[model samples]
Target: MPYLSPADIRSKTFRRKRQGYDPGQVNEFLLIIADALAGRLRLNPDHIRTVRFAAVPNGYDPLSVDGVLHLLEFQVRNGIVPPTGLNSGEDLRARKLPRSGTGYDRAEVDAFIARAAANLDGRGSMTSTEVRNTRFSTTSGLLGKGYQVQAVDTLLDDLEQELRFRGR
Candidate 1:
């Protein structure tokens, strides 16, 4: 069997012991080992996962698959998706709309964009629907009092800019 690199050993070693080496010292050593290994074998620390955001037809908005994936990951991290089968469409819909809430705030929208950006790191474009759905769902909640469904749609043009969506 090939010998493990020092970085590999360090990863395991770092996990143990109550009085481990100072973090700075340990990190310094790891960097040196990383450099040495970098010359011996190609390591792609910068490699990114490829994701494709599908297109949305004329007039609807929803999260792209990538955007959805990001939202799902965030939801999972926050215990919002539960432990299993979280990606099911029904489940996602449930999370998108709480039983009783005014709706997503500016912060929520910002968070959604940030999550999508992370999930689609190097991906080109995003589905128009994906962006719309996020807005629609959120707006639906925000416009709860004396808010007409049709009236909510009237704000789409303005909201689109905030969402950074490119209309198809």
Candidate 2:
């Protein structure tokens, strides 16, 4: 959704999760965003950057979606259109996995996010080119289930696609 525009925000359909965002509240906010986009006005970019939410039962972590919104706002303000997911960059959201869970290893996943951020932000040596070809092995630990391999691989594929799009 980082690629969503103001108009896109207006037209986009958000699914109602049984326990996702408060539909009313999120929809209201989207309207504000769309209006601001239409008016060429910058709203609370700083607020969006720093905002956090209290998790509700069944409500998705608003941050997951907000992060994309923040990115979109930043790009719009800077007058740059971030290419679609297929274009450029290796950015990802990191999630912590329990030491004993059916999730990717917390350490490895975090490390990957760090690397992706660095590469995308140009703070590391790995070029976007390298990221496109990079691959990771599933983790091995004395205890706990690692993040599902398929899930992590899928994410990597997405990250790679982003990088490839950017590289192109």
Candidate 3:
């Protein structure tokens, strides 16, 4: 299941509001919108499971698209199959992502680490608005909340550590 459906997102029904639109009708409409969007997105029954299992959850952030994509790319690069049901031709095609079964070069891995570090370091020195607008994309939703670059970098660090421990 998706984390939240479009209807759940767009629904007008919410906490009670004084002098607000009709709660019942708005909420119902949101649900409809969400369902329609969900259908269009082709969200699978296992989408939530896939995301949740991709990483151990922390209090602030859930696994994000970038994180998941990173993990998937890492797995592919290292020739390690992730510990979940992400292997399918349809899903791969749906994302329109390419996989040539080639691993990252040692130089590329080093460069990736350097880039992640630079991104994290720059975030520490930048203003909130700059970080929010230039660093993280809104497309990530809740996953794109505060300090997304840091989150992704931290995840990359963990992944790299795991890869090293595994003797990748």
Best by TM-score: 2
**Model 1: residues with Cα > 4 Å off, grouped in runs:** 1-104, 123-126, 136-168
Instruction: Give the Cα-based TM-score of candidate 2 against the true structure.
Output: 0.36
Candidate 1 worst ten-residue window by lDDT: 80-89
User: For residues 32-59, what per-residue lDDT tens digits would candidate 2 score against the true structure?
Assistant: 6654543334676565565444444565
Candidate 1 residue pairs that clash? 61-129, 61-133, 62-129, 62-130, 62-133, 63-130, 102-141
- Considering TM-score, where higher is better, how would the candidates rank from best to worst? 2, 3, 1
Model 2 Cα shift for residue 78 (angstroms): 1.6
Better of 1 and 2 by TM-score: 2
Which 10 successive residues of model 2 have the least lDDT summed?
82-91
Winner of 1 and 3 under lDDT: 1
- Strongest candidate by lDDT: 2
Q: How many clashes in each candidate?
A: 7, 9, 7
**TM-score of every prediction relative to native:** 0.19, 0.36, 0.20
Q: Write the per-residue lDDT of candidate 3 for residues 9-60, one digit (tens) a residue.
A: 4422233333333444434433433333323222332332333222222221
Where is model 2 more than 4 Å wrong at Cα? 14-19, 52-63, 80-168
Against the reference, the lDDT scores of all candidates come to 0.34, 0.53, 0.31
